[model samples]
Target: MVLLTLWLTWAAASADTTKFDVQPFKINLGSEIPRLHALVNNTRLPSKALYGVGQDKGIELDFLAELRREWLEVFDWEAQEAELNRFTQYTAEIEGLTVHFVHEKSADPDAIPLILLHGWPGSFQEFAPIIKPLTTPTENVSFTVVVPSLPGFVFSSPPPRANWTVDDTARIFNVLMTEVLGYKTYALHGTDWGSVVGYSMYGSFNTTVRAAHFVFLPFFGPTPEEIAADNITLSDVEKVAENKGNLFVSLGLAYRDEQTQKPNDIGLALYDNPVGQLAWIGSKMKLWSDPRAGTPPSVLNTTAILTSVSLYALTSSFLTSVWIYASNPNGFSTTYSQAPTDAPMLFSQFEYNIIFYPEEYVKQTTKNLVSYKVHDFGGHFPGLDNPPALIEDIREIAAVFVR
Candidate 1:
């Protein structure tokens, strides 16, 4: 693994420039689209059903029907691309790979730098609302927020070779922050799969990252009590978190299993069938959403969820990311050998997301532990669901380290 990092086995990719660009930079609706109008009209979402009135109720029977109609009829790739391109985006080669990212900097030159990392089936679009507040804190946080489409996702190029892993990505990011932006230190935040990316940033180059925060705390080790007691303490908590992954043994590790094993097969499916893609991601968005919370605000809007995911999905990088998983099963697994001084780290255990009891995980890791706060609001995709609460927590925790 170290060798892969030392000598870039990864190949540098030149841009995949296409001459035929979509005018208006949006996907064009085909001539046949109007025919699907019947389905679109047939699928009407009733006002109050399934979780009701505007909150994330399970796509009302009517809405689902509409989703079917719209999806079958009006789902336009160009529209989403236009919306995506509206955000300032750029791609650059780093560490032998094409990396795509968005850098929304606060107008204030003095604002701190914060890197927001996204997870699997997710893209930087998740950070849209949260970015403004972070970039303008007080008034706003006033930080330059950089959201990157991890290598292999969307605009970014694929992993140079089969050996690239999270550590390499973190190293490349270190270059992005200090070398690219010239920030001696910056706060880092990530969710879901990105928890690993953000965490690895500290581990890969502890000296560079000032602080790191994660909405999803990923650890594949024993709990702290287990470590201290020197006995089997079990995970000690149950998160309703079930996915197509947990549906079966291999399924439980579906993301991991696929990433490690058959990433291409999964990616091919996501690309071939939009419905297949929706069911795969939509199911989880539904599961993570609290029926009590009404319609799980942050994670997705079933159809809109596809936007962020499809951004990555259409690129075919989803398969590459899966392969990364297949390659590095223990990518985020923290052990003694590759430990760093615990930088200030905060892990918000969304009431609904998995909580392996991070405080316990903290005790086991070898970092100069700072603080860890388990928040009550927002699970998995905190950026969209609970921006205000996330804003407050980030402000409080980030203040301690930024200074």
Candidate 2:
């Protein structure tokens, strides 16, 4: 009787861990490419700013014009789609929402399961470069990489109702990792809004989420009192990062505020306007990255930028994607929990990112911080800016599992 009870318990647990019904997906922009080009060709550019201070005013007229010309003349959506299809893509229904993701399983049977999360104005494309390397078995480690498109971004469906907070996203993704994919344990890495979701999982699903890594930490800004505390001495590098962060908060929060407060307004306005979508996301791609990040002289490669903008326009996800900010307006101000999470945490700080968290601030916010790294190059989108470094950092965090 005792043996039967134990067997039943084990059977139930195994049954609960069934693999998700994930269907193969491919990006086919057959007619959409020509349609996009037509819109780009028809777009009427505003006159060049009279007092042109360059990017300060917004995406430069000449820059937009050049990009428009490329979109209309040189950019090939079909080719780009084919390249994107190189990775195995799939969509699974989780809580009535269709979740789109790339699941690149490592050849090694013992590979670590790792989920990579991306933020707004970015998608699973952000992790394209690192996917192969992470999947390739190294002497020390190998990873089965899963990159999910946050709901309402690209292929993923929008929330069934409005006001889907980061916490909600975390819950759905937990289902994706554990229940659907049948991973008993996994690690997470994220940037921008992705970090918010990853943090949510780390805090809420401690039993399954063993470790997490982030390039961005939402709602973790240091208080004035903490900054002014006598024990903390600011290094020159730290001071520069702090000053840059302050400047960004003062000048760069307009987009965030608008997105959070009045998403429908902007979403409606830019819903059908492909050029408008381009300008909205393109400016950030140009400004937020390290100038020295990409293969092109400017950090924002024209082709890459266009690819991201096209995805938004093609899928009509701009409005719903921006709704994430509105859903969690108080997220940045609200503490995730009363105490720090027990799950091991790791953070990577880039110098030119919009916001910078000093080592002290990160240490204070994360209780079980196993690693904190500062890179000379790279920005908010470190995967695109410096993928090798990002991969290496992920490996460093993964080391904790073995230890």
Candidate 3:
């Protein structure tokens, strides 16, 4: 991302804001909410440009062609769509923007109230595979899950103005939980952009959020000195936040830069070439997932990788996802911007997508952090990769907060 001079800004103040007033649908017996019937029409990615992996990216010719062919043949957008709409969804207005979300309530009435937020190029749809496990852990800790589409994401509308940073979005989510759902106290978690939003809410409604759990939290808390008494080993897996990440982002972050600094321009091309889109995205999955371990397309084949990777693409969320970068270039501005948005004050190293933070440097940053939990196996998309494990982890974490 290394483009501090620029970060994705919300749609220009001057850009037209399309307003759609959606009414509520009776989703659950007593928990009905408004559903937006907004339809997007202006998208038209350049068919040819999308066919080629950016030559400048230096991808091998064969891989690029393979990427293109697979996208054209293997990826099925229609199936992805039907799979998504299968859930009960709704859209609501917040802060001059319409937000789209999928709400899944657990049968356990006493289940903890929780909300899941997604970042760029990802929609609520990504959580589908893991939904059952998380919502009804072992059919035990049931949760009324609310997964919201970040503004400009698949189902949500873009901002009418600029300056929609993590704080801005988190503020809205806070309202949604307390006002809309009437849950004054709940758990908030997120991935990528959702992580950032979760961070903001962690403080914005610190009194309410029981404890925030993020698979990709960037900010630092402890120094080895502080946690030395407890003695926790900071593994490369944990340091993946530095760049290698649990299973994604570093290699593909450059694309985030282009979106931040020149999103409109990037979008102009990506909108058309679904092939190009697949290549750009596939390249990241290649680098993040063990290339030597799995098939050429590990993300497409493995359940977790496939679920996480395919989450948004199936829904054509790329449009709204990139718009986040296009709108707030600053958030995704650093090569390491992929790092945590929450740790503004922590002296962190090898942070996000940009310049590699190196192993030792990352080791230095997370030394003393308390409440630091590390896991094995699950990559960028733990929920998709091993929902049962993630669900167990969440259940354990939530036990402290649930009354």
| Candidate that would win on lDDT | 2
For 1-403, candidate 3 gives per-residue lDDT tens digits of: 4243122211110121233333443222111111101111122233444455654364445654554444444644445556666666767776778777776766555567778876544456557766666676554566778887787775566766655677788888887776655566788667767776776676567666765565554332333343345455555644544334422332345776777777667666665444455556655544433333243222224332333334444345565567666555555322222222232212112222222233333334333222434444444444443455456555654555633
lDDT of 1 by residue, 1-403 (tens): 6555323312111122332111122223334335433433443445546444431323335544555555655667567666656566666567667667776767655566788888766677777767777777575346777787777766666887877777778788787776655567788888877877787786777777777776664565344445457643333232232221133222234455665677677877655444455555555555454333334445445456656545544544556655657656776554533357456776555555533344555555545556566545455566666666677667655555653
The whole-model lDDT of each prediction reads 0.59, 0.81, 0.52
- Give TM-scores for every candidate, taking all chains together and pairing residue i with residue i: 0.73, 0.91, 0.67
**Model 2: pairs clashing at backbone N, Cα or C within 3 Å:** 20-180
Q: Quote model 3's TM-score.
A: 0.67
Q: Which 10 successive residues of model 3 have the least lDDT summed?
A: 30-39
After superposing candidate 1, which stretches have Cα over 4 Å from the reference?
1-66, 73-83, 221-251, 292-299, 332-338
- Runs in model 2 deviating more than 4 A are 1-20, 223-231, 234-236, 296-300, 334-340
lDDT of 1: 0.59
Error of 1 at 367 (Å): 4.7
